[model samples]
Target: MTSPRRTFAIISHPDAGKTTLTEKLLVAGGAIHLAGEVKARGANRRARSDWMKIEQQRGISVTSSVMTFERAFDDLGVITFNLLDTPGHEDFSEDTYRTLTAVDSAVMVIDAARGIEAQTRKLFEVCRLRSVPIITFVNKVDREGRPVFELLDEIADMLALDVAPMSWPIGMGGEFEGVLDLETGGVSRPEGDSRNFQGKVDTDVTLPERFAEEVELAQAGYAEFDAEAYRNGDLTPVYFGSALKDFGVAELIDALARHAPAPRPQPAEPAPIAPEADEVTGFVFKVQANMDPNHRDRIAFMRLCSGTFKRGMKLTPTGHGKPIAVHSPILFFAQNREVADEAFPGDIIGIPNHGTLRVGDTLSERADIRFTGLPNFAPEILRRVALKDPTKTKQLRKALDDMAEEGVTQVFYPEIGSNWIVGVVGQLQLEVLISRLEAEYKVAAGLEPAPFDTARWVTGDAGDLKAFADLNRGAMAKDRDGNPVFLAKSAWEIGYVADRYPKVRFNATRER
Candidate 1:
């Protein structure tokens, strides 16, 4: 029998050493010989899992990147690891949700110095809502003066997580040295340092007096977690480490293998749909187009929701003159592409040599049940761009279409001949697009900050005035102008703004 697979997503606030953690995990699992670093300029600079050009330049992940790792578990024997690395920014939260929906659990990384911030809380809530088990890691303990205990308390309070430390920090802040594994009672520190350890605990150590006390306290806390505690509904476990120094990484890997839940049994394939259903039958989650002298090609990343896709599969895709044959089954790995001979239920595989798949469009392998809805995209932040040369307008349109297909961007054409309006998740996202355009297509796009609406609810005359001004680009909206406009239609947007601008009290009657 085949070994079971475990799927989990890694999430965190921006710059919290998430990619660093991922690299360590991949290395520990023997997926790569030596770990790669995120350099400002280099051949392999960005997150190894983060393969997008836009993502590398921005230094922020805009989409979830999936990769598999395998390692032996002390208790579970051999395990297949299916890990998804998610975006840290708020605008890409929708992408994060989709990634989570496909996985069984998550590892939430937090900065030791910064503790839990707004995005951390938001993502945690989403996990809670999905009832996904989560493990929390407090990273960057190598930095001096980091308050490990205090950060642990903050994580539990801010995120309301039932967290217990799996290891104790040997020292914190500037004097930080290593970690004491609570389970094995082993001590692992920087390799070169001459720190003698008799067993799991150190003897005659020079650790901070307060830290020594905290170690004992941390062990006690772990002891307190009984089967009943887990059964009664606790969702998070806290671990400490410095990904930069690689200290405690082994223990973290061990904890993941031990505590993280395995993916549930794969469900039986869905029944075949009829030969004709107009409800938008298949989903195009990814797209890549290549044009060379010999061949003009487009690869559509698809997930067959309710049908089977085999060799010679056929479907009448929208905007196509006739049903195109499934020319070849393909798989996308960042810039590299390959062909998969067959694909089936719940598998995300790519297809090449076809013209019909659009981001968010559904496809049908059989003709019966259809998947109509596109995964939700957050409200776009509007910006103005002028082509460096008028002649490059057509080239720019094709480039933008590819970007949209990749799901990292949104392009809007307000009018037929208007200067193109590109909706982006954040400023960094725009910078990345421009950089890619100039370098790859020899086109430099000039961007000008444009006024955009992030609606806030207000009711009292003062509140109404403020709300109206925000809608008209007058007051608070102007103050926070560059931010992406909050979708006025979403209750989440309404409640978020209402709490943010409490002074602009809502008149229940008017709101209704």
Candidate 2:
């Protein structure tokens, strides 16, 4: 029998302590030794998940990271946990969306002080769209935050999610004594200055007399925890704690193993693929380049949907109906990885590939099964790449192509110029592009202001599109995939051009 798998993502707005929580969860699972603060210098301070230099410098997760670890639960036996840490910045929403498609559920991290934020709401909507159940973790309870009722009401009102507080804080900020587990009635408090987990949860259903009425009232106000409702994405079982303090993370993991659904059937063409399906089926939700800067390797993050995937198996990618051997299937704990001899449903395995595998490419024993819903959003920002050395133009082209395939940026070749244009959704992406260009590719390139501010896919009759393209040849360009796109100078220009060419459709997003 397959080991039980719980695949989920951690999402939040910027500075919600999602990264800290991720580290603590890893420590609890025995994946790592310690959960150190970001301020601590040297190797000891570095987070395993935040491996990129740019990430370390900027203190942000610009790309989604895939991490896997395992732990034993008394009720569920030993279970495999796959955690995808998504970027909190709204700019990386595209990457987050793709990562969500590959998970069974998500852990929505909201700051107790700020409550539901803009990026958090956006990510929640993405989760809701796919019916992805969420386990809410209200972090920073050790610090001063909004009242419990206010936060819970905001969750109920803003997200429309039924709030089920699994655990409640005894008090907040300096007065914060500990958290009382509602289900187990176990209480654990901070022991010393370290704030590490006490590891001793008194399973007595006793509550402090002072806070008894408050707990009672809050429990009465919110709906009871219904496993069915949560699995259906109608409700969220909330846990409150300070991830920085290593509080409530263990309970959060327990909640995941106990309540979170196992590898569910994945949406695919023809029919949804069940976990027990005979054929080995999976889809590439992300392709990252230069994960190992030394070897310049490219890895495709594939989420197994069905069957037992063994090493040295040849799976055909839907992108190119050709069989590719996956020799080095990797099970990841952030950047630390090991060769996965075999993987089951809901397991995310890293398949090192060349340019053949891409985001949204489905790999299976056969070519017929193609998983869907990975999207490619049109770039919100475009810039012309000016290489420091013109002699290295070919190398820059190769690097840009590699990055494009990885979804880090989109490279567009215009019908007009030799200088290729790179596009991204936000300003940070431009910084990442330049950083990677120097660090990984050994080709230093600078991004100059592009004439076009926005780009859109042009779709319509061949004659009509050609007529439009012919009229505005300067704005015409082809994506790496050879798809025609019209680069508009600005939003107003897009509107003006659309008015003139009514038959042509300008798509902001394209199906991968």
Please report the candidate that would top TM-score against the real structure: 2
TM-score against truth, every candidate: 0.67, 0.92
lDDT for each candidate structure: 0.58, 0.84
Q: Per-residue lDDT for 116-199 in model 2, tens only?
A: 887788888888887899999989887767878878888888669898878777652123334433334444344432222212
Clashes of each: 16, 0
The TM-score that candidate 1 achieves is: 0.67
- The lDDT, on a scale of 0 to 1, for candidate 2 is 0.84
Residue 90 of model 1, lDDT score: 67
Write the residue-wise lDDT of candidate 1 on 227-342 in tens digits.
23432337466666788777667777776666665443321225433323222244555454542213546666554443446666676654443566776766433344456665
